[model samples]
Target: MRPFYCLTFICLSFAAAAQGVDPAITERPPSAAQLPGVDAPPGPAPRPTPPAARPSPAPSAESSSPLPDKDPASRVERLDALFADLKRASTSATADRTVDKIQAEWAASGSATADLMLIWAGEAVTDKRNGAAFDFLDQAILMKPDFAEAWNRRATLNYIASDYGKSLADIERTLQLEPRHFGALMGLGAILEATDRKAQALEAYVRVLEIYPTLKGAQDAVGRLSEELAGQRI
Candidate 1:
């Protein structure tokens, strides 16, 4: 999987700030995961086939559905209530250590909205529960089809699960939604690199550098591609 530079920077900064130190004072650890060979056991099985797209739920004929009402007040109130319930359910001392706690919190809170689903998806990815993560991201996409981060994350999960075709599709969608999404561009670069599409991969890395000039991975990618192109010319 491609390393997420933004996430790494944020995590490192947070760690440094926690210790009352300047983030620049510490050397950031290398961020790449060792890409194992084909001999390694494959990642988790592909997620179950997704359900057919269902029509969106429409407001009942009787009630004024929040769908038509663009008022933020009611939506904010519901969000507040949902967060309060989630906070209450997540208060168990042992919850931090147990997946059951996450499951219970999700189950108990009827108001766990699409935003919460995205949060859960992130946790699922960290836990290596790719199947669960896909489900949560799917829900998030259904709720907000235009959410670029959700699509980018789902693409990453697909990449990890070795579904490159699906990963490519999702990453494309992510880029279409957010042209400057460095993560998606990086993912596309990695996928193209793996497929031996060096020129395309170079373009992707260049695009990422355009958005995030300090991204080390993109710099490294450019160097690698330059070397490859030089070798071809020679």
Candidate 2:
């Protein structure tokens, strides 16, 4: 139950954020200091990304559709444009392409070491080696505190591990770093819905739509939560 609550918290938070873009209302996310291994000393220094792990970035719509600059500010600009394109996307194929580009941008964490670490973490997850994934993600975050996707990945890990408290914290941080993250928003909505926070969940799913109007899951969540809440009111 608690674990579900954690995922739901992330989902609800995300959905709500999707509806609103409020940077002023901040929530603490999982930081290195807050998770289990603050004092455990750093993991091994990141090695060169394994050939297979350094998989290609998500496919881009054009060879040069967005910014190629790698600074945080430039990443923001690139994401801003992709998000705009995402909002205007009329078909699922267009939306997915834009989403892939956005994910690719998230994967580019400035620090080559951190990026490689993230790739390793992703591979670990695929291999069902969550412990390894956690270690890699932790190190990645350690190296690049501003890498929102690392936090988001950890959030999913926490959710899968039934560590909702940590997952929710990670979700909060992910949103703080990148508020327009619909994936995180979806997680927040799931947590809220799981915990019976219907009104909040409804609000969250609604917001997700604001950012990504074509999202079928958020749309379904909104529809159901709205009907349920309305029935309760009646």
Candidate 3:
């Protein structure tokens, strides 16, 4: 039972509950301070991202083509456009849809072999076979080192395995490959909070909010941390 196993269990339980399944949220261990670290940042307020232009109604003919062709650069540009839309989304529902579109772009690796390996790795993670999942993900990265999605998936599995340091490292790599990755930014915030680096954790959450303002968790987290830090000054 790895340390991340408990966190994974809690997350799965939450997902189940969200789907109207009657599972309870699992409690973390006393030492599981990292889970709350995401809510402890006390640093100077992070600058909000400047608002981008509101997206025009997407062309109907191209709505079906969410995934880009084999051109990695083109795919990145596609993702960038989606992220821009997400940042400017006027409604939470719109932001949610944009996030899904971004994720869809990330899922297509442009290489059949790497994509297959990613599926295997995802299944392994579901099965709680962290070592096996890690191996598959590593192979995927080897097959397509520039695949930001593969690195992000491995970072998630590493977080679940409680290899926080490795998870953070992979997240950094993921961001280097795709800077607008809100998922990686959120993970980095969580790890920072767990390590008692509350200020940095807050900054990470702030970044996530900037990328996706309708993200409820980050919204609550920013509120909570802001109050906590303000109290300390009293």
- Top TM-score model: 2
What is the model-wide C-alpha lDDT for candidate 1? 0.50
Candidate 3, residues 55-107: lDDT per residue as tens digits?
76767886655544866678768877888898898887787567556655665
lDDT of 1 by residue, 149-205 (tens): 567667666766768788778877766765645556666777777878788878777
Clashing pairs in 3: 34-194, 37-193, 41-198
Q: Model 2, range 1-234, lDDT digits (tens) per residue?
A: 000112333323222222221111112111111111011224554455446656568767774454557455777788899899989999766776676576667666788778666666655654567788788889889999998877877887787777767877987898788777776666666656666677876766676677767666666777887889989999
TM-score of each: 0.56, 0.72, 0.70
The per-prediction CA RMSD against the true structure, in angstroms, equals: 14.0, 10.7, 14.2
Candidate 3 lDDT (Cα, 0 to 1): 0.58
The lDDT for every candidate, in the order shown, is 0.50, 0.60, 0.58
What candidate 1 gets wrong by more than 4 Å, as runs, is 1-112
Candidate 2 structure, TM-score to reference: 0.72
- Order by TM-score, highest first: 2, 3, 1
Badly placed stretches (over 4 Å) of model 3 are: 1-68
Top of the candidates by lDDT: 2
lDDT of model 3 at residue 86? 82
